[model samples]
Target: MSKRWIGLVVVLWVTACSPIDPKLKQYLVEGERLYVLHCSNCHQRDGQGLRRVYPPLAGSDYLKENLPRVICSMKYGLQGEIIVNGIMYNQAMPGVPSLTELELAEIATYLYNSWGTQTGLIDARRIGPLLDSCARPRPRR
Candidate 1:
């Protein structure tokens, strides 16, 4: 094939592979709103968190590794000491138990896709199971 044809095929393939999902876009928009209203207080609008107080969500190793725990924590709250980016943070993060699975998914989608992270869409369907797993009672510190 000619060079121009080869380039055209590459471009077409790239575009086809990465089509934007409208649902994801909606999730992101709603998620931002929810984050600002519910989470941005501690995590901050930039997701930098407070200086050594609230853990920074931006480029957070904890967030990246503990997706299931994060989802659960969103509904069940998190207590005691948790480490993010090798720094230990001891804070009582209250969960918004009223947030529906869709809202949780939207917030998560926004968080994972923002601040130097690109984890794509986190579907609401996947959240239910994660929430269920952490529904049991546990001791708090």
Candidate 2:
């Protein structure tokens, strides 16, 4: 094969492998709305949480590494210390137990794609099973 043909093939392959999903825009819009309603109060509109209190989602290291934990925490709440971008946060974050799987997926998709991360759509189909296995918080002593 010629160099030009090889280059064209490579470009075609890359494009085919990364086609933008049609539902992404819809998901992002819904997610942003839901985040404003359900999460912005604490996490803030820009995802910059209050100083030394609520953890910021903007460029959060915790979010990058803890997708499962984040998912579970959304529905079940979170307690104890968690490191976000090397900062130690020990505050208790209450979850939204009422959010459905689709809602959670939308929110996840927004957060993961917004700020600095680009994790794309977090499908509700992928969310349901993970939520089923969420680890419940222990009762306070």
Candidate 3:
């Protein structure tokens, strides 16, 4: 094969491998909106929260490794010890159960995706189960 053909093949291969999902993009946009309405005040518009009161979401380890826990907290709020960035905080994370399941999912997706490396969507599929589990905890976390 000619060098020109090889270059064309490489370009096509790259394009095919990294197809951006339109739905995923759409969810991200909506998630931003959800974050604003529900989380911005405490976490701030830039995901930076008030000192000792709210928790920063930017570069948050809890947001990444403990994704499910984040979802649980969002669904039912936190009442005990919590860490944000490198700081430890103990505050009442007010519940937002009034938010629809979709809204919760969107916010979850936004926070999860915003931190360091992007993550898979925390959509209705994962959220439905998590919410169900957290809202009425048979065994507390």
Top TM-score: which candidate number?
Answer: 1
Q: Is candidate 2 or candidate 3 better by lDDT?
A: 2
Candidate 1 local distance difference test against the native: 0.92
Model 3, 1-141: lDDT tens digits are 999999999999998888777766777899899888878988899887788788788877777677667877776777878776678888788767677777777777778778565876767677777766654544546
| Candidate 2: tens digits of C-alpha lDDT, residues 117-139 | 89888998999789777777777
Better of 1 and 2 by lDDT: 1
Question: Candidate 1 — which residues are off by over 4 angstroms?
Answer: 1-18, 135-141
Model 1: per-residue Cα lDDT over 80-101, one tens digit each: 8998999999999998989999
C-alpha lDDT values of all predictions: 0.92, 0.89, 0.77
Candidate 3 CA-lDDT value = 0.77
For all predicted structures, in order, the TM-scores are 0.84, 0.81, 0.76
Candidate 3: which pairs clash?
none
Weakest lDDT window of 10 consecutive positions for candidate 2: 131-140
What's the CA error at residue 14 for candidate 2, in Å? Answer: 16
